[model samples]
Target: MKKILSILCFLICVNAFSQILSSNLEKKTLALGEVNHFIIKIDNLNNQQVSAAAKNELLPFHFEEIKDSIGTQPNLYERKIDFSVYEEGKFTIPELEFKVGDKVLKTIPYEIEVINTAQKGDQINDIMNNKEVKLEPKDYWELYKWYVLAALSVIALIVVIFMIVKWGRNKKSSPVVATNQTLKELDSLKKKKYIEEGNYRSFYVELLDISRKFITKQYNVPADVLLTDDLVQLMKTNNTISRDNEKIVEDVFLRGDLVKFAKTFPDKEIMEKDFTDIREFVKRSSNDLEFENLRKDV
Candidate 1:
Protein backbone atom coordinates (compact mmCIF):
# COMPACT_ATOMS: atom_id res chain seq x y z
CA MET A 1 0.00 0.00 0.00
CA LYS A 2 2.88 2.44 0.73
CA LYS A 3 4.52 1.74 -2.66
CA ILE A 4 1.17 2.23 -4.52
CA LEU A 5 0.48 5.54 -2.68
CA SER A 6 3.96 6.90 -3.50
CA ILE A 7 3.50 6.03 -7.20
CA LEU A 8 0.13 7.86 -7.29
CA CYS A 9 1.71 11.03 -5.79
CA PHE A 10 4.46 10.98 -8.40
CA LEU A 11 1.96 10.76 -11.24
CA ILE A 12 -0.06 13.65 -9.80
CA CYS A 13 3.07 15.83 -9.58
CA VAL A 14 3.97 15.04 -13.19
CA ASN A 15 0.47 15.99 -14.34
CA ALA A 16 0.71 19.33 -12.56
CA PHE A 17 3.82 20.33 -14.50
CA SER A 18 2.36 19.57 -17.94
CA GLN A 19 3.39 22.00 -20.71
CA ILE A 20 0.88 23.88 -22.90
CA LEU A 21 1.29 25.33 -26.37
CA SER A 22 -1.09 27.66 -28.22
CA SER A 23 -1.06 29.75 -31.35
CA ASN A 24 -3.14 32.71 -32.51
CA LEU A 25 -3.50 34.76 -35.63
CA GLU A 26 -4.38 38.41 -35.54
CA LYS A 27 -6.58 38.09 -38.62
CA LYS A 28 -7.45 35.46 -41.23
CA THR A 29 -7.56 37.89 -44.15
CA LEU A 30 -5.28 40.83 -44.88
CA ALA A 31 -4.83 43.18 -47.82
CA LEU A 32 -1.71 43.12 -49.87
CA GLY A 33 1.10 45.12 -48.26
CA GLU A 34 -0.81 45.01 -44.94
CA VAL A 35 0.94 43.41 -41.99
CA ASN A 36 -0.43 40.65 -39.72
CA HIS A 37 0.82 39.11 -36.52
CA PHE A 38 1.11 35.44 -35.66
CA ILE A 39 1.68 34.73 -32.02
CA ILE A 40 2.83 31.54 -30.32
CA LYS A 41 2.58 31.03 -26.59
CA ILE A 42 4.04 28.31 -24.44
CA ASP A 43 3.21 27.76 -20.77
CA ASN A 44 5.34 26.09 -18.13
CA LEU A 45 8.37 26.53 -20.29
CA ASN A 46 11.47 28.69 -20.33
CA ASN A 47 12.30 30.12 -23.79
CA GLN A 48 16.00 29.75 -23.11
CA GLN A 49 15.57 25.99 -22.87
CA VAL A 50 13.35 25.80 -25.96
CA SER A 51 14.98 24.93 -29.26
CA ALA A 52 13.32 25.54 -32.62
CA ALA A 53 14.86 22.79 -34.68
CA ALA A 54 12.48 23.24 -37.63
CA LYS A 55 11.81 26.75 -38.88
CA ASN A 56 8.32 27.80 -39.96
CA GLU A 57 8.04 28.11 -43.72
CA LEU A 58 6.35 31.34 -44.87
CA LEU A 59 6.25 30.76 -48.61
CA PRO A 60 3.57 33.04 -50.05
CA PHE A 61 3.85 35.53 -47.20
CA HIS A 62 6.97 37.61 -46.74
CA PHE A 63 8.35 37.45 -43.25
CA GLU A 64 8.95 40.97 -41.97
CA GLU A 65 9.86 40.70 -38.31
CA ILE A 66 9.94 38.39 -35.31
CA LYS A 67 10.23 39.12 -31.58
CA ASP A 68 10.00 37.08 -28.42
CA SER A 69 9.29 38.05 -24.83
CA ILE A 70 8.44 36.49 -21.53
CA GLY A 71 4.73 36.32 -20.78
CA THR A 72 2.77 37.21 -17.65
CA GLN A 73 4.28 34.25 -15.81
CA PRO A 74 7.99 33.54 -15.59
CA ASN A 75 7.52 30.12 -17.11
CA LEU A 76 5.46 31.40 -20.01
CA TYR A 77 7.04 32.58 -23.27
CA GLU A 78 5.50 34.32 -26.25
CA ARG A 79 6.70 34.93 -29.78
CA LYS A 80 5.20 37.30 -32.35
CA ILE A 81 5.96 37.20 -36.06
CA ASP A 82 5.00 39.86 -38.57
CA PHE A 83 4.32 38.95 -42.19
CA SER A 84 2.74 40.33 -45.32
CA VAL A 85 1.84 38.87 -48.69
CA TYR A 86 2.33 40.77 -51.91
CA GLU A 87 0.39 38.45 -54.19
CA GLU A 88 -3.27 37.73 -53.48
CA GLY A 89 -3.93 34.10 -52.56
CA LYS A 90 -4.71 31.70 -49.79
CA PHE A 91 -1.65 30.38 -48.03
CA THR A 92 -1.16 27.91 -45.24
CA ILE A 93 0.86 28.93 -42.20
CA PRO A 94 3.06 25.90 -41.64
CA GLU A 95 3.05 24.08 -38.35
CA LEU A 96 5.56 25.46 -35.85
CA GLU A 97 7.25 23.29 -33.27
CA PHE A 98 9.77 23.76 -30.51
CA LYS A 99 11.48 21.39 -28.14
CA VAL A 100 11.07 22.37 -24.49
CA GLY A 101 13.01 20.13 -22.15
CA ASP A 102 12.17 16.57 -23.30
CA LYS A 103 8.77 17.55 -24.69
CA VAL A 104 8.01 18.88 -28.18
CA LEU A 105 5.12 21.34 -28.53
CA LYS A 106 3.51 21.94 -31.91
CA THR A 107 1.05 24.49 -33.29
CA ILE A 108 -1.50 23.36 -35.86
CA PRO A 109 -1.29 24.77 -39.36
CA TYR A 110 -3.81 27.47 -40.40
CA GLU A 111 -4.83 29.08 -43.66
CA ILE A 112 -4.60 32.84 -44.28
CA GLU A 113 -6.20 34.70 -47.17
CA VAL A 114 -4.44 37.56 -48.89
CA ILE A 115 -6.57 39.99 -50.88
CA ASN A 116 -6.03 42.82 -53.33
CA THR A 117 -8.78 45.44 -53.17
CA ALA A 118 -7.50 47.28 -56.21
CA GLN A 119 -8.22 44.34 -58.50
CA LYS A 120 -11.62 43.53 -57.01
CA GLY A 121 -13.78 45.68 -59.24
CA ASP A 122 -13.78 47.40 -62.63
CA GLN A 123 -16.74 49.72 -61.99
CA ILE A 124 -15.75 53.33 -62.42
CA ASN A 125 -17.80 56.19 -61.02
CA ASP A 126 -18.83 58.93 -63.44
CA ILE A 127 -17.20 62.29 -62.97
CA MET A 128 -19.62 65.07 -62.10
CA ASN A 129 -19.61 68.30 -64.07
CA ASN A 130 -18.02 71.32 -62.38
CA LYS A 131 -20.44 73.89 -61.01
CA GLU A 132 -20.19 77.52 -62.09
CA VAL A 133 -19.98 80.18 -59.43
CA LYS A 134 -21.05 83.80 -59.73
CA LEU A 135 -18.64 86.27 -58.17
CA GLU A 136 -19.54 89.53 -56.43
CA PRO A 137 -17.36 92.57 -55.62
CA LYS A 138 -16.59 91.05 -52.23
CA ASP A 139 -15.51 87.80 -53.88
CA TYR A 140 -13.20 89.75 -56.21
CA TRP A 141 -11.72 91.47 -53.20
CA GLU A 142 -11.23 88.08 -51.50
CA LEU A 143 -9.37 86.76 -54.56
CA TYR A 144 -7.15 89.84 -55.08
CA LYS A 145 -6.65 90.43 -51.36
CA TRP A 146 -3.88 87.80 -51.46
CA TYR A 147 -1.95 89.96 -53.97
CA VAL A 148 -2.36 93.02 -51.76
CA LEU A 149 -1.13 91.08 -48.74
CA ALA A 150 1.75 89.74 -50.80
CA ALA A 151 2.85 93.27 -51.76
CA LEU A 152 2.68 94.40 -48.12
CA SER A 153 4.55 91.28 -47.03
CA VAL A 154 7.32 91.93 -49.59
CA ILE A 155 7.70 95.51 -48.36
CA ALA A 156 7.77 94.44 -44.76
CA LEU A 157 10.35 91.75 -45.55
CA ILE A 158 12.58 94.33 -47.28
CA VAL A 159 12.39 96.66 -44.28
CA VAL A 160 13.11 93.78 -41.90
CA ILE A 161 16.12 92.72 -43.99
CA PHE A 162 17.47 96.30 -44.00
CA MET A 163 17.09 96.55 -40.21
CA ILE A 164 18.76 93.15 -39.76
CA VAL A 165 21.73 94.18 -41.94
CA LYS A 166 22.13 97.46 -40.04
CA TRP A 167 21.99 95.64 -36.70
CA GLY A 168 24.38 92.95 -37.95
CA ARG A 169 27.05 95.61 -38.82
CA ASN A 170 26.99 96.66 -35.15
CA LYS A 171 27.02 93.06 -33.78
CA LYS A 172 29.97 90.74 -34.32
CA SER A 173 29.27 87.36 -35.97
CA SER A 174 29.10 84.49 -33.46
CA PRO A 175 28.95 81.09 -35.16
CA VAL A 176 29.87 79.44 -31.88
CA VAL A 177 26.59 80.56 -30.35
CA ALA A 178 24.56 78.23 -32.57
CA THR A 179 27.00 75.37 -31.98
CA ASN A 180 26.86 75.94 -28.23
CA GLN A 181 23.06 75.90 -28.25
CA THR A 182 23.08 72.56 -30.10
CA LEU A 183 25.59 71.07 -27.64
CA LYS A 184 23.46 72.34 -24.76
CA GLU A 185 20.45 70.52 -26.21
CA LEU A 186 22.48 67.32 -26.37
CA ASP A 187 23.58 67.83 -22.77
CA SER A 188 19.97 68.33 -21.72
CA LEU A 189 19.01 65.06 -23.41
CA LYS A 190 21.72 63.25 -21.43
CA LYS A 191 20.38 64.74 -18.19
CA LYS A 192 16.96 63.20 -18.86
CA LYS A 193 18.31 59.77 -17.86
CA TYR A 194 16.25 58.01 -20.52
CA ILE A 195 18.68 55.09 -20.84
CA GLU A 196 18.79 54.65 -17.09
CA GLU A 197 15.02 54.41 -17.07
CA GLY A 198 15.10 51.85 -19.92
CA ASN A 199 13.22 54.16 -22.28
CA TYR A 200 15.56 53.58 -25.20
CA ARG A 201 12.80 54.09 -27.78
CA SER A 202 12.02 57.60 -26.64
CA PHE A 203 15.72 58.34 -26.26
CA TYR A 204 16.41 57.37 -29.88
CA VAL A 205 13.40 59.36 -31.12
CA GLU A 206 14.56 62.57 -29.49
CA LEU A 207 18.19 61.93 -30.39
CA LEU A 208 17.30 61.53 -34.05
CA ASP A 209 15.12 64.65 -34.02
CA ILE A 210 17.92 66.72 -32.53
CA SER A 211 20.51 65.31 -34.91
CA ARG A 212 18.28 65.91 -37.95
CA LYS A 213 17.70 69.50 -36.92
CA PHE A 214 21.40 70.00 -36.40
CA ILE A 215 22.11 68.55 -39.83
CA THR A 216 19.55 70.84 -41.42
CA LYS A 217 20.94 73.93 -39.72
CA GLN A 218 24.62 73.13 -40.11
CA TYR A 219 24.53 71.74 -43.66
CA ASN A 220 21.46 73.52 -45.06
CA VAL A 221 20.02 70.12 -46.00
CA PRO A 222 16.42 68.98 -45.49
CA ALA A 223 17.43 66.26 -43.05
CA ASP A 224 14.23 66.41 -41.05
CA VAL A 225 11.93 65.89 -44.05
CA LEU A 226 13.87 63.35 -46.10
CA LEU A 227 13.79 59.62 -45.50
CA THR A 228 16.95 57.88 -44.30
CA ASP A 229 17.95 56.62 -47.74
CA ASP A 230 17.07 59.92 -49.37
CA LEU A 231 18.90 61.91 -46.74
CA VAL A 232 21.96 59.69 -47.07
CA GLN A 233 21.88 60.04 -50.82
CA LEU A 234 21.55 63.78 -50.56
CA MET A 235 24.42 63.97 -48.11
CA LYS A 236 26.59 61.94 -50.43
CA THR A 237 25.61 63.97 -53.47
CA ASN A 238 26.20 67.32 -51.81
CA ASN A 239 29.45 66.17 -50.19
CA THR A 240 29.02 68.83 -47.51
CA ILE A 241 30.18 66.34 -44.84
CA SER A 242 33.04 63.85 -44.92
CA ARG A 243 32.31 60.26 -45.93
CA ASP A 244 33.25 58.97 -42.47
CA ASN A 245 30.98 61.43 -40.71
CA GLU A 246 28.17 60.64 -43.17
CA LYS A 247 28.57 56.92 -42.48
CA ILE A 248 28.32 57.55 -38.75
CA VAL A 249 25.13 59.55 -39.18
CA GLU A 250 23.67 56.88 -41.47
CA ASP A 251 24.37 54.10 -38.99
CA VAL A 252 22.79 56.07 -36.17
CA PHE A 253 19.72 56.78 -38.25
CA LEU A 254 19.34 53.12 -39.21
CA ARG A 255 19.69 52.03 -35.60
CA GLY A 256 17.12 54.61 -34.57
CA ASP A 257 14.69 53.09 -37.08
CA LEU A 258 15.25 49.61 -35.68
CA VAL A 259 14.63 50.82 -32.16
CA LYS A 260 11.58 52.89 -33.02
CA PHE A 261 9.78 50.70 -35.55
CA ALA A 262 11.12 47.17 -35.02
CA LYS A 263 11.12 47.36 -31.20
CA THR A 264 14.80 46.36 -31.10
CA PHE A 265 17.04 47.29 -28.22
CA PRO A 266 20.68 47.76 -29.09
CA ASP A 267 23.66 47.42 -26.78
CA LYS A 268 24.10 50.20 -24.21
CA GLU A 269 27.63 50.81 -25.44
CA ILE A 270 26.42 51.27 -29.03
CA MET A 271 23.79 53.77 -27.89
CA GLU A 272 26.41 55.82 -26.04
CA LYS A 273 28.72 55.70 -29.04
CA ASP A 274 25.92 56.93 -31.32
CA PHE A 275 25.30 59.91 -29.05
CA THR A 276 28.99 60.72 -28.98
CA ASP A 277 29.28 60.37 -32.74
CA ILE A 278 26.43 62.80 -33.35
CA ARG A 279 27.95 65.31 -30.91
CA GLU A 280 31.30 65.08 -32.63
CA PHE A 281 29.67 65.41 -36.04
CA VAL A 282 27.93 68.58 -34.93
CA LYS A 283 31.11 70.18 -33.64
CA ARG A 284 33.23 69.17 -36.61
CA SER A 285 30.61 70.20 -39.16
CA SER A 286 30.07 73.52 -37.44
CA ASN A 287 33.79 74.27 -37.45
CA ASP A 288 33.98 73.41 -41.14
CA LEU A 289 31.03 75.69 -41.87
CA GLU A 290 32.63 78.52 -39.87
CA PHE A 291 35.87 78.12 -41.75
CA GLU A 292 34.05 78.21 -45.08
CA ASN A 293 32.17 81.37 -44.01
CA LEU A 294 35.40 83.06 -42.98
CA ARG A 295 37.00 82.15 -46.28
CA LYS A 296 34.02 83.61 -48.15
CA ASP A 297 34.22 86.81 -46.11
CA VAL A 298 37.90 87.20 -46.89
Candidate 2:
Protein backbone atom coordinates (compact mmCIF):
# COMPACT_ATOMS: atom_id res chain seq x y z
CA MET A 1 0.00 0.00 0.00
CA LYS A 2 2.84 2.39 0.82
CA LYS A 3 4.58 1.60 -2.48
CA ILE A 4 1.34 2.27 -4.42
CA LEU A 5 0.89 5.63 -2.66
CA SER A 6 4.50 6.60 -3.42
CA ILE A 7 4.00 5.73 -7.10
CA LEU A 8 0.91 7.94 -7.31
CA CYS A 9 2.70 10.84 -5.60
CA PHE A 10 5.64 10.49 -7.99
CA LEU A 11 3.27 10.59 -10.97
CA ILE A 12 1.60 13.75 -9.62
CA CYS A 13 4.94 15.45 -9.07
CA VAL A 14 6.06 14.58 -12.59
CA ASN A 15 2.84 15.95 -14.06
CA ALA A 16 3.21 19.21 -12.12
CA PHE A 17 6.65 20.00 -13.60
CA SER A 18 6.29 18.28 -16.97
CA GLN A 19 5.08 20.12 -20.10
CA ILE A 20 3.82 18.87 -23.44
CA LEU A 21 5.30 20.79 -26.39
CA SER A 22 4.12 20.11 -29.90
CA SER A 23 4.55 21.96 -33.21
CA ASN A 24 2.08 21.46 -36.03
CA LEU A 25 2.10 22.77 -39.59
CA GLU A 26 -1.12 23.01 -41.60
CA LYS A 27 0.70 21.53 -44.59
CA LYS A 28 4.23 20.34 -45.22
CA THR A 29 4.07 21.53 -48.83
CA LEU A 30 2.86 24.88 -50.13
CA ALA A 31 2.67 26.88 -53.33
CA LEU A 32 5.00 29.81 -53.71
CA GLY A 33 3.85 33.00 -51.90
CA GLU A 34 1.14 31.05 -50.06
CA VAL A 35 0.95 31.32 -46.31
CA ASN A 36 1.65 28.25 -44.21
CA HIS A 37 -0.05 28.10 -40.86
CA PHE A 38 1.91 26.80 -37.87
CA ILE A 39 0.70 26.17 -34.37
CA ILE A 40 2.55 25.41 -31.15
CA LYS A 41 0.74 23.94 -28.20
CA ILE A 42 1.85 23.34 -24.66
CA ASP A 43 -0.19 21.47 -22.11
CA ASN A 44 0.00 20.85 -18.37
CA LEU A 45 1.42 24.27 -17.64
CA ASN A 46 0.47 23.89 -13.93
CA ASN A 47 -0.21 27.63 -13.64
CA GLN A 48 3.44 28.51 -14.33
CA GLN A 49 3.94 31.46 -16.74
CA VAL A 50 5.20 30.73 -20.26
CA SER A 51 7.15 33.27 -22.30
CA ALA A 52 9.37 33.30 -25.42
CA ALA A 53 12.12 35.72 -26.25
CA ALA A 54 11.52 37.65 -29.46
CA LYS A 55 15.21 38.01 -30.23
CA ASN A 56 15.75 34.26 -30.29
CA GLU A 57 13.28 33.78 -33.09
CA LEU A 58 14.54 33.91 -36.67
CA LEU A 59 12.67 33.52 -39.96
CA PRO A 60 13.72 32.77 -43.54
CA PHE A 61 14.58 35.67 -45.81
CA HIS A 62 11.66 37.40 -47.55
CA PHE A 63 9.23 35.29 -45.55
CA GLU A 64 6.40 37.27 -43.99
CA GLU A 65 5.58 36.25 -40.44
CA ILE A 66 2.25 36.85 -38.74
CA LYS A 67 1.89 35.85 -35.11
CA ASP A 68 -1.70 35.01 -34.33
CA SER A 69 -1.62 34.12 -30.69
CA ILE A 70 0.26 33.72 -27.47
CA GLY A 71 -2.67 32.02 -25.82
CA THR A 72 -2.81 30.94 -22.19
CA GLN A 73 -5.39 28.79 -20.50
CA PRO A 74 -5.64 27.27 -17.00
CA ASN A 75 -3.21 24.55 -18.05
CA LEU A 76 -2.68 25.12 -21.73
CA TYR A 77 -0.49 27.47 -23.82
CA GLU A 78 -0.70 27.88 -27.60
CA ARG A 79 1.00 30.00 -30.23
CA LYS A 80 0.03 30.43 -33.87
CA ILE A 81 2.48 31.82 -36.37
CA ASP A 82 1.89 32.18 -40.10
CA PHE A 83 4.83 32.24 -42.49
CA SER A 84 5.08 32.74 -46.25
CA VAL A 85 8.16 32.76 -48.49
CA TYR A 86 8.15 34.65 -51.77
CA GLU A 87 10.84 32.46 -53.29
CA GLU A 88 10.29 28.74 -53.76
CA GLY A 89 12.53 26.20 -52.07
CA LYS A 90 12.78 24.07 -48.94
CA PHE A 91 12.94 26.19 -45.79
CA THR A 92 13.05 25.25 -42.14
CA ILE A 93 11.49 26.81 -39.09
CA PRO A 94 14.09 26.54 -36.36
CA GLU A 95 13.37 25.22 -32.90
CA LEU A 96 11.56 27.76 -30.72
CA GLU A 97 12.31 27.97 -27.04
CA PHE A 98 9.74 28.84 -24.42
CA LYS A 99 10.63 29.72 -20.85
CA VAL A 100 8.42 28.11 -18.26
CA GLY A 101 9.36 29.68 -14.93
CA ASP A 102 12.88 28.26 -14.40
CA LYS A 103 12.99 25.63 -17.14
CA VAL A 104 13.04 26.13 -20.94
CA LEU A 105 11.17 23.90 -23.36
CA LYS A 106 12.04 23.79 -27.05
CA THR A 107 10.02 22.63 -30.03
CA ILE A 108 11.53 20.54 -32.80
CA PRO A 109 12.40 22.20 -36.13
CA TYR A 110 10.04 21.75 -39.08
CA GLU A 111 10.84 21.63 -42.79
CA ILE A 112 8.59 23.28 -45.34
CA GLU A 113 8.67 22.62 -49.07
CA VAL A 114 7.60 25.44 -51.36
CA ILE A 115 6.96 24.73 -55.04
CA ASN A 116 5.93 26.88 -57.95
CA THR A 117 2.20 26.41 -58.46
CA ALA A 118 2.29 27.39 -62.10
CA GLN A 119 4.68 24.54 -62.93
CA LYS A 120 2.90 21.81 -61.00
CA GLY A 121 1.76 19.62 -63.88
CA ASP A 122 3.43 18.05 -66.91
CA GLN A 123 2.27 20.94 -69.08
CA ILE A 124 4.57 23.90 -68.67
CA ASN A 125 3.46 27.42 -69.49
CA ASP A 126 5.20 30.74 -69.47
CA ILE A 127 5.13 32.57 -66.16
CA MET A 128 3.79 35.62 -67.94
CA ASN A 129 1.49 33.81 -70.30
CA ASN A 130 -1.14 36.05 -71.83
CA LYS A 131 -4.70 34.86 -71.65
CA GLU A 132 -6.93 35.55 -74.60
CA VAL A 133 -10.29 37.15 -73.97
CA LYS A 134 -13.11 37.25 -76.45
CA LEU A 135 -14.31 40.77 -77.11
CA GLU A 136 -17.11 42.24 -79.15
CA PRO A 137 -16.41 44.27 -82.32
CA LYS A 138 -17.60 47.40 -80.51
CA ASP A 139 -15.02 46.75 -77.78
CA TYR A 140 -12.19 46.59 -80.33
CA TRP A 141 -13.40 49.83 -81.95
CA GLU A 142 -13.61 51.53 -78.56
CA LEU A 143 -10.06 50.55 -77.68
CA TYR A 144 -8.34 51.35 -81.01
CA LYS A 145 -10.13 54.53 -82.14
CA TRP A 146 -7.95 56.85 -80.03
CA TYR A 147 -4.75 55.11 -81.23
CA VAL A 148 -5.87 55.48 -84.89
CA LEU A 149 -6.55 59.19 -84.43
CA ALA A 150 -3.12 59.68 -82.77
CA ALA A 151 -1.34 57.85 -85.60
CA LEU A 152 -3.15 59.89 -88.31
CA SER A 153 -2.29 63.17 -86.53
CA VAL A 154 1.40 62.14 -86.35
CA ILE A 155 1.42 61.21 -90.07
CA ALA A 156 -0.20 64.52 -91.06
CA LEU A 157 2.41 66.51 -89.04
CA ILE A 158 5.27 64.54 -90.65
CA VAL A 159 3.83 65.06 -94.17
CA VAL A 160 3.50 68.83 -93.60
CA ILE A 161 7.14 69.14 -92.36
CA PHE A 162 8.47 67.03 -95.30
CA MET A 163 6.51 69.16 -97.91
CA ILE A 164 7.87 72.40 -96.39
CA VAL A 165 11.52 71.15 -96.70
CA LYS A 166 11.60 69.26 -100.07
CA TRP A 167 15.37 68.72 -100.08
CA GLY A 168 17.83 69.72 -97.37
CA ARG A 169 21.64 69.59 -97.09
CA ASN A 170 22.80 67.34 -94.25
CA LYS A 171 25.37 68.79 -91.82
CA LYS A 172 27.97 66.47 -90.30
CA SER A 173 28.79 67.39 -86.74
CA SER A 174 31.40 65.96 -84.37
CA PRO A 175 29.77 63.65 -81.83
CA VAL A 176 30.30 64.48 -78.19
CA VAL A 177 31.01 61.49 -75.96
CA ALA A 178 29.10 61.58 -72.69
CA THR A 179 31.55 60.86 -69.87
CA ASN A 180 30.65 58.26 -67.25
CA GLN A 181 27.02 58.09 -68.45
CA THR A 182 26.55 54.47 -67.35
CA LEU A 183 27.78 55.13 -63.83
CA LYS A 184 25.52 58.21 -63.63
CA GLU A 185 22.57 56.13 -64.83
CA LEU A 186 23.37 53.45 -62.23
CA ASP A 187 23.17 56.13 -59.54
CA SER A 188 19.81 57.28 -60.94
CA LEU A 189 18.60 53.67 -60.88
CA LYS A 190 19.50 53.45 -57.20
CA LYS A 191 17.42 56.55 -56.53
CA LYS A 192 14.37 54.81 -58.01
CA LYS A 193 14.47 52.13 -55.24
CA TYR A 194 12.61 49.48 -57.21
CA ILE A 195 13.97 46.70 -55.02
CA GLU A 196 12.78 48.40 -51.84
CA GLU A 197 9.36 48.89 -53.45
CA GLY A 198 9.21 45.09 -54.15
CA ASN A 199 9.24 45.76 -57.88
CA TYR A 200 12.00 43.18 -58.54
CA ARG A 201 10.98 42.47 -62.12
CA SER A 202 11.13 46.10 -63.09
CA PHE A 203 14.42 46.44 -61.27
CA TYR A 204 15.98 43.55 -63.17
CA VAL A 205 14.60 44.72 -66.53
CA GLU A 206 16.01 48.19 -66.02
CA LEU A 207 19.28 46.76 -64.72
CA LEU A 208 19.70 44.65 -67.82
CA ASP A 209 18.78 47.59 -70.05
CA ILE A 210 21.40 49.82 -68.43
CA SER A 211 24.12 47.18 -68.68
CA ARG A 212 23.24 46.23 -72.25
CA LYS A 213 23.22 49.84 -73.39
CA PHE A 214 26.64 50.42 -71.84
CA ILE A 215 28.11 47.31 -73.46
CA THR A 216 26.65 48.27 -76.80
CA LYS A 217 28.10 51.80 -76.77
CA GLN A 218 31.47 50.85 -75.22
CA TYR A 219 32.23 47.70 -77.25
CA ASN A 220 30.35 48.60 -80.44
CA VAL A 221 28.44 45.34 -79.92
CA PRO A 222 24.66 45.13 -80.42
CA ALA A 223 24.09 43.94 -76.84
CA ASP A 224 20.60 45.47 -76.73
CA VAL A 225 19.59 43.58 -79.87
CA LEU A 226 21.22 40.24 -79.00
CA LEU A 227 19.70 37.60 -76.75
CA THR A 228 21.18 37.14 -73.28
CA ASP A 229 23.06 34.02 -74.37
CA ASP A 230 24.32 35.72 -77.52
CA LEU A 231 25.45 38.79 -75.65
CA VAL A 232 27.23 36.65 -73.03
CA GLN A 233 28.98 34.85 -75.88
CA LEU A 234 30.06 38.17 -77.34
CA MET A 235 31.45 39.23 -73.94
CA LYS A 236 33.32 35.93 -73.71
CA THR A 237 35.05 36.68 -77.03
CA ASN A 238 36.15 40.16 -75.95
CA ASN A 239 39.88 40.20 -75.00
CA THR A 240 39.54 43.57 -73.24
CA ILE A 241 37.22 42.25 -70.49
CA SER A 242 38.85 39.69 -68.25
CA ARG A 243 37.32 36.20 -67.98
CA ASP A 244 36.35 36.84 -64.37
CA ASN A 245 34.60 40.04 -65.39
CA GLU A 246 32.88 38.21 -68.23
CA LYS A 247 31.60 35.61 -65.73
CA ILE A 248 30.27 38.40 -63.55
CA VAL A 249 28.36 39.87 -66.45
CA GLU A 250 27.11 36.46 -67.48
CA ASP A 251 25.88 35.70 -63.96
CA VAL A 252 24.07 39.02 -63.77
CA PHE A 253 22.36 38.52 -67.12
CA LEU A 254 21.35 34.93 -66.33
CA ARG A 255 20.00 35.83 -62.89
CA GLY A 256 18.20 38.83 -64.30
CA ASP A 257 16.64 36.61 -66.94
CA LEU A 258 15.38 34.28 -64.20
CA VAL A 259 13.81 37.19 -62.33
CA LYS A 260 12.28 38.64 -65.47
CA PHE A 261 10.98 35.40 -67.01
CA ALA A 262 10.70 32.81 -64.23
CA LYS A 263 9.52 35.12 -61.44
CA THR A 264 12.47 34.31 -59.24
CA PHE A 265 13.46 36.81 -56.53
CA PRO A 266 16.97 36.45 -55.16
CA ASP A 267 18.02 37.55 -51.73
CA LYS A 268 19.07 41.19 -51.29
CA GLU A 269 22.72 40.26 -50.84
CA ILE A 270 22.87 38.77 -54.34
CA MET A 271 21.09 41.78 -55.77
CA GLU A 272 23.57 44.11 -54.10
CA LYS A 273 26.49 42.03 -55.39
CA ASP A 274 25.12 42.23 -58.92
CA PHE A 275 24.88 46.00 -58.61
CA THR A 276 28.42 46.28 -57.32
CA ASP A 277 29.86 43.96 -59.96
CA ILE A 278 28.11 45.81 -62.76
CA ARG A 279 29.53 49.09 -61.50
CA GLU A 280 33.00 47.57 -61.46
CA PHE A 281 32.55 46.07 -64.91
CA VAL A 282 31.43 49.42 -66.36
CA LYS A 283 34.28 51.35 -64.75
CA ARG A 284 36.97 48.94 -65.90
CA SER A 285 35.52 48.55 -69.40
CA SER A 286 35.21 52.30 -69.85
CA ASN A 287 38.88 52.74 -68.92
CA ASP A 288 39.85 49.96 -71.33
CA LEU A 289 37.90 51.60 -74.17
CA GLU A 290 39.57 54.96 -73.53
CA PHE A 291 43.00 53.32 -73.44
CA GLU A 292 42.30 51.61 -76.79
CA ASN A 293 41.22 54.95 -78.30
CA LEU A 294 44.40 56.63 -76.98
CA ARG A 295 46.56 53.90 -78.48
CA LYS A 296 44.79 54.24 -81.84
CA ASP A 297 45.39 58.03 -81.81
CA VAL A 298 49.07 57.47 -80.95
The per-candidate count of clashes, in order, stands at 0, 0
lDDT string for model 2 (221-247, tens) is 798899999888777775555676678
For every candidate in turn, the CA RMSD to the true structure comes to 10.4, 13.7
Q: What TM-score should be assigned to candidate 2? A: 0.40
lDDT per residue as tens, model 1, 131-215: 9999999999999999999999999999999998888555543557667778999999999987666566678989999989877
Give candidate 2 regions above 4 Å deviation.
1-179, 290-298
Instruction: Assess each prediction's global lDDT (C-alpha) against the native.
Output: 0.75, 0.75
Model 1: residues >4 Å from true position, as ranges?
1-23, 30-71, 78-174, 290-298
Model 2: lDDT of residue 193:
86
List TM-scores for all candidates, in order: 0.54, 0.40
